[model samples]
Target: EPEVTQTPSHQVTQMGQEVILRCVPISNHLYFYWYRQILGQKVEFLVSFYNNEISEKSEIFDDQFSVERPDGSNFTLKIRSTKLEDSAMYFCASRGTARGNTIYFGEGSWLTVV
Candidate 1:
């Protein structure tokens, strides 16, 4: 089975700075997503992409965040400005058409905003 992969496994940034996290989901997957888990909290959905466009996003994914599939294989999440509240482990996920919506997640990109 293929797995989602993420770059810069960990990052530390100052508050109000910009950060971009990158991922490569399983090659055959059809749907992609971004999710984040704040320290000691449950994972929260951020956004989902399908057919080269954003299909859905959560309230927590406000103006400060954006997602894109820059190429056939790369999916990225950009935080326009980081905040202490944004410190969390961001995960990249994907699911194929036959998986019954069972998304597979990457190890995660841990972000620390000071």
Candidate 2:
């Protein structure tokens, strides 16, 4: 069984610094997404990518954030000028098909901005 994998399970950074979270999804998956949860908040959707382009994005994905698939294998999320409010547990997920397909999520990458 294939699963999503994330690097640097936890990251600590200063405010105004930049951070990149990396993830690799199952080889056969087509749709990919990024979601985050504040320490005591509900999980929130950030962005969804498909066919090399952003298919959907939530308000949280503002100018400071970006996502890319530099090598068609690894998906990365870059946050520029991080703020204390940016600290959260970010999850990378992927799905094979849209209908009745299960979305697999990687072990979250915890980001701490202080």
Candidate 3:
């Protein structure tokens, strides 16, 4: 079975520092997304990417954030400057088709900003 994989499952960073979370989605999946869950909050959609361009994004994905697929296989989320509010479990997800299709989520990459 295909699944999404994330690297550096745990990361600790100082406030105002930069951080990058990496992921590899199922090979045949087309839609990719980034979602985050703050310690006690619901999972929130950050951004979605398809066809090499941003398809949708939440207000949380502001100027400090960016996503890129440097290689066809790897997707990366970069935060230019982190804040205490940025600490959360970030999940990388993908789906073969659309909303009705099954979406695969990677084991979250936990980011801790001090």
Candidate 4:
């Protein structure tokens, strides 16, 4: 089965730095989503995109964050300025929209801001 892929499974950065995380969602999926988890914390949804616009977004998607479809198969998330609290597992996910459908997670791009 096709799977969502993310690069640099782990990232470490200094405070106030910038970071760009990459993801390749499933080939045929229609909906793309981003979620994050601080170590030992719960999963939190950040944003969802469909048809090139943001379908939904949570409060956590602040000005420091932005997403884009850079190509037919690649999606990216950029953190303009990282902070110590930005350290966490940032997961990229995709699904076909069934409420009951299982979404695929991209292993995860763990960011550590020190």
For each candidate in turn, the TM-score is 0.96, 0.97, 0.96, 0.94
**What is the per-residue lDDT of model 3 for residues 23-77, given as tens digits with 9 covering 90 to 100?**
9999988899999999999999999999999999999999999999998899999
User: lDDT of each prediction vs. the true structure?
Assistant: 0.95, 0.95, 0.95, 0.92
Give the higher-lDDT candidate: 1 or 4: 1
Count clashes in each candidate, considering only residues at least 3 apart in sequence or on different chains: 0, 0, 0, 0
Model 3 misplaced stretches (Cα beyond 4 Å) = none
**Which of candidates 3 and 4 reaches a greater TM-score?**
3
Clashing pairs in 1: none
lDDT by residue for model 2 (1-114), tens = 789999879999999999999999888888999999999999999999999999999999999999999987999999999999999999999999664599999999999999
Worst 10 residues of 1 by lDDT: 95-104
Taking the tens digit of each residue's C-alpha lDDT, what string does model 4 give over 1-114? 779999989999999999999999999887898999999999999999889878898999999999999788988889999999999999999987565588999999999999
Candidate 4: residue 77 lDDT (0-100):
88
Q: Is candidate 1 or candidate 4 better by TM-score?
A: 1
* Local distance difference test, candidate 1: 0.95
